[model samples]
Target: MKALAGDLGIETAVSFPGRLTTDELSSLLGTAWINLHFSVAEGWCLSVMEAAAAGVPTVAYEVPGISESVVPGTSGLLAKDGDIGDLTNRVTEILHSPQHWWASSRRVVESRGWDRVAEDWERYLTVVFSSA
Candidate 1:
């Protein structure tokens, strides 16, 4: 992770296994942090969802599952799925361009709250109950 971070010109602080618990990870992510999870592919990745819930914008590769998870320019920016140059450029943009990055952060704040998600669920449940 450090190497990947360095290649992207971002400094990374890693906690060895057992060094950080879930609360610590949450706290670390709760700060002014930009989370990156550039997996080649994923299936309903919780990290991306959790980061959005924590109000942290993300940078990820443009792939099928990831695409479903992150809305580019809103929750995060997408780079070429397997191209290092594109990844570097996107990461650099997030690191150096505060406005674009914060736009994503604000997007998260605008629509990713628990209240918003719960409301969606409530609506679904209401329809289901009424139909039943």
Candidate 2:
């Protein structure tokens, strides 16, 4: 990737830091400019959601899982599935606009916190068992 970019006269340096520990992951989210989630399949992307929580925007494909966390054009930008060119464009779009960082972060509306989700689940189970 570096060689390709260099060949194209692009000066940006890209690094892929493989699997980080929990603390490292947290730190990365807090400090990174953006999260690019390219997973083809996901139930829902915890990383994407966490990025949102950390006020970092994401660039992802428009699939069921990623869609749950990334609100297209708000929290982040989305591209049609398998459209690498579109995804690249979206990334460039976000990086070029300075205010987009704040706007995307502020616009992210988390669906629910883990505590709330757990509470709702417990309440649902209690009601179902009580009726049974």
Candidate 3:
């Protein structure tokens, strides 16, 4: 992780192997200057959601679940899907611009949040419970 972070010209930290706790991870994410995830495929990115909840600005590759997770130019910046250069450019854009950072912080909180997710879940559960 450190090597990759270094290669990307960013600072990195890791949790104890096989002992990665969500709260611990969230704490680390909370302190991050910026949270970035460049995965090629994701069914659903809980990490991005968590980072947004932590009020951490995020940068990620624009892919299937990613678009749903990170609201581009708001909660986080997304590189053109399948374009590495675009990813790099988006990251650079966010890192260099202070206004973008503040905007992202607010966007993440307002848009992508567990509160909203939980409400959705609750609605679904309510329907299920009513049927039961």
TM-score, per-candidate, Cα-based: 0.69, 0.66, 0.66
For each candidate in the order shown, give its overall lDDT on alpha carbons.
0.74, 0.80, 0.74
Cα distance off (Å), candidate 1, residue 126: 4.5
Order the candidate numbers by lDDT, best to worst: 2, 1, 3
lDDT by residue for model 1 (1-132), tens? 667767777654553345677898778677755778869979866788677766666788888888878877777778888888988777777777655665566566558667889999999999999999
Residue 90, model 1, lDDT: 74
lDDT of 2 at 50: 78
Screening candidate 1 with a backbone cut-off below 3 angstroms (N, C-alpha, C), the clashing residue pairs are none
Candidate 3's C-alpha lDDT? 0.74
Candidate 2's residue-wise lDDT over 22-66, tens digit each?
888878777778888998878978788778777788999988888
Q: Candidate 2: which stretches are off by over 4 Å?
A: 1-12, 16-19, 106-111, 115-132
CA deviation > 4 Å runs, candidate 1: 1-14, 17-19, 99-103, 109-114, 124-132
Report the Cα lDDT for candidate 2: 0.80
Query: Where does model 3 exceed 4 Å of error?
Result: 1-18, 98-103, 106-132
**Candidate 2: minimum summed lDDT over ten consecutive residues — where?**
102-111
Pairs of colliding residues, candidate 2? none
Ranking by TM-score: 1, 2, 3
Tally clashing residue pairs in candidate 2.
Answer: 0
